[model samples]
Target: MTMAQARGTTDGWPDGTFRNPVLPGFHPDPSVCRVGDDYYLVCSSFEYFPGVPIFHSRDLVHWEQIGNVLDRPGQLTLPPSTASSGGVYAPTLRHHDGRFWLIVTNCADGGGNLLVTAEDPAGPWSDPVRLPGVPGIDPDLTWDDEGDCWCTYAGIEQVRIDPRTGRTIGEPRRLWSGAPGAQAPEAPHLYRVGGYWYLLIAEGGTERGHAVSVARATAPGGPYEPCPANPVLTHRGTNRPIQNTGHADLVEAADGSWWLVLLGVRPGGGTPGWHVLGRETFLAPVTWVDGWPVVGGVEPVMAAPPWPARPTPQPPARDDFDAVGLHPRWVSVRSRPAESWSTTERPGWLTLRARGASMDERDVTFLGRRQQHPSCRVRTLVDPAGGRGGLVVRLDERHHHGVEVGDGEARVLVRIGSVLATVATRAVPAGPVRLRVDVLAPAPGDWHPGKEPDVLRFGVESADGTFDVLAELDGRYLSTEVAGGFTGRVIGMYAATGSVHFDWFDYQPEDGDGDPTPRDGGAI
Candidate 1:
């Protein structure tokens, strides 16, 4: 399929005011860079085949997905033993000397730290340049005024590297471990601003205690001093709606203002610790104090966007399967079924040939997109003629819930590790069926400070008939807290026993809101 640019025309929503989670649903460990009046960002994709998802924007408030850096098997390879959160870790995007560079770690099968370069942000990027000795993850690169380049990584370690080859030029030096009490010092970024080198890191794990901290020194490798107030920003121990706030990237806007792009989770009220939408990308303004950067607290909803209006391309609500291949937003767990799926087999239908691998296996036959909202509905029309597989809400291989039609039975099944529970089942006639899943707000709990759990309802229908409710499952089982992964809930179509065909798939938020406005005349 030819590469098409995804654009958003946000002329429908009210001007100026915007929402939090600028990029919602599993868009974690965000890294961003600015060039002239345009802004570009990239996020971690873990076991997802496309690796890093790239976004473009003129104004910081709005963003549209341009393309993925690793779109082919030649660029990245995920082994069968790779865990759901084990393929690609945090990725850093940088624009220097008129070229765009991406550095990431593929944690599967010893696929360590590597680099890929492209002249265009929307890329046909180069193959991986392995950084053999750079240990740990979340690697960042910066150039000094003296023409020296340095790499700072997860263990709070630094080394000089040759940009041409991923070879180290010096010994790995240990830096400040961050504040006294925080744990898991990772996601390190260095910036040279105003004669001072600012170093940023996220610590205290990525759960309730997660936070963003800062330290600065006169040189790249420091005798760094931690900020007087320590953790520059965090939502831990607070009653705020956004939680697990950390893993941030800083960019200077065209208007000379500093903005922060970070990952945060929006927990449902009453559900407390349960969150199904996963860690999302959030935006906030930054203010400087005594040459130190401080992040402005983020809210669930922003009354006004900080930057001028810009155009953003939004993902379509429904996919017709008429294109030559899948949309850019469509992704698969670990290895995608290259020969197991097709769109041209039946013209307008998407055909999925059944593989013996079930949903619990790493090489399952599945195609999915991020579940972007708490209150949303996903439905797909499938022809399961003497076959199986339908719509599935997946957290990982072992933790997933699906409403499948196969083996002459239509059922809703939930699997947690070695245990499998069938929620509901019914007999189905031999033709096509429509499967739908609705995500409802969580019931309030006493321990939860206004957080909500994802309550999922499954149903099925035929031709002109109405949907029949099968079962309701709590979404917390598919959450990061329970499933234990660096990914969010992905809802999509899959087949298991026999070949199945999907006619179309639809997705939309319950609120029925449209795209945000694009910057004036900046649509591409």
Candidate 2:
């Protein structure tokens, strides 16, 4: 975690701008909710699927997903995930009073937590009530301006809640107990304002003691208190290599300022733990001061803050997938079987029909996208016309990796979940097997190895040696913090519900100047 403290601060300010995970790839545990300049966010997609995506911002730094609240498959509970387990975890996008809700915790199967609505947050949302006896695992829902509505998860023996309506809630008192002080207590989040009732949570857990505390209690159950900076948004003692940082969510900005979306990365490298570019989406600049809430002002650096001036139309990163479904920022690891791939039967081409070749570890069907560059180049035209569709970067199903196509036989599979070591067979390029992969990193003062390799000290060592760094950028790059699941990034086209279907899927990302080049893959 050293290279002069992992470096990460945008320098002189202004290029693509600066700051903590302000929405990078595979966004995690974020939950913003503003509504005047219009903001709306949602994250935590565990087993991935079209679950809880829905983004849309006006100026909180260019975001635009706009749909996906469990897009199908009975509204979700997607199993078959490994890197960890099945779909939906830590979601809470509220609009309240007039309606907008979303409150999830579908850790897989209705063990509890689930509610949906839509006064429109770009959603048609509904279907998914199940809430009865809920307990923990990132829930969040606070109302009180007088409207009442509390619900913050992670149990000790219930924890403080009172929902009782949108499907039932109420009865939770276990109070505090977190940090290495363990005992669940994860991602709670509640915030009432002046009279106080903070709660907040995310205590010393997520990884390397992530921490983001607060306790306050005026009612809503509590003996609460803490927050004297009790591990506020931690690094344990600032050795800084960006290990975990507690799941969080709190938004104000529309003028009132206040921001803190949470989730950080840079653990090991090349494919371990965070899997480069995954646990993304960050931003901290909350300063309520005298009444609490204060971050990134006294220490804890990370940079990239100055993106607000004309962003309501930054769309067109190019997607000719033509849309009919999939795009609320697209996500999929489970819940995808309609035969796994299709497009209204195909029109201009985006037919990735690989019903069953390899989706990573515990059974996958990737449509992935979220490695965001330290060196990017992912060309794909595949026609697994001989079998097994291609092009992936998954980080689960054991520790996935990719580059495939199998019509006339061409491969490069790397699986680590159920272990596929590295296949490497090639031959399908007689026509359009295209395939191009790139992951370069290591450039700052240049020593060659990943200067910020999360904390493995260096990088590269994967025939199963187990070091796990995956993402740690801004110094010599290396960006890949993907995390067990809870999705984001979702690139386009797929097929193999049981067979082939890559008539076309041109993913683009290649400006590569490290040398030895051959650029011109399609789709912007």
Best by TM-score: 1
lDDT of 1 by residue, 280-372 (tens): 999988889998997887985555545547767667899989999777788987767568889998899998887755788778888899998
lDDT tens per residue, model 2, 246-341: 677777776676878788664433223233566776676778777888876322244444443444443344455666555555566665676656
Query: lDDT score, residue 181, model 2?
Result: 59
Residue ranges of candidate 1 with Cα displaced over 4 Å: 1-15, 269-272, 303-306, 443-452, 512-524
Whole-model lDDT for model 2 versus the true structure? Answer: 0.57
Estimate TM-scores for all models: 0.93, 0.35
Kindly give the stretch of ten consecutive residues in candidate 1 with the minimal lDDT sum: 515-524
lDDT of 1 at 303: 51
Task: Kindly state the number of residue pairs that clash in model 1.
Answer: 17
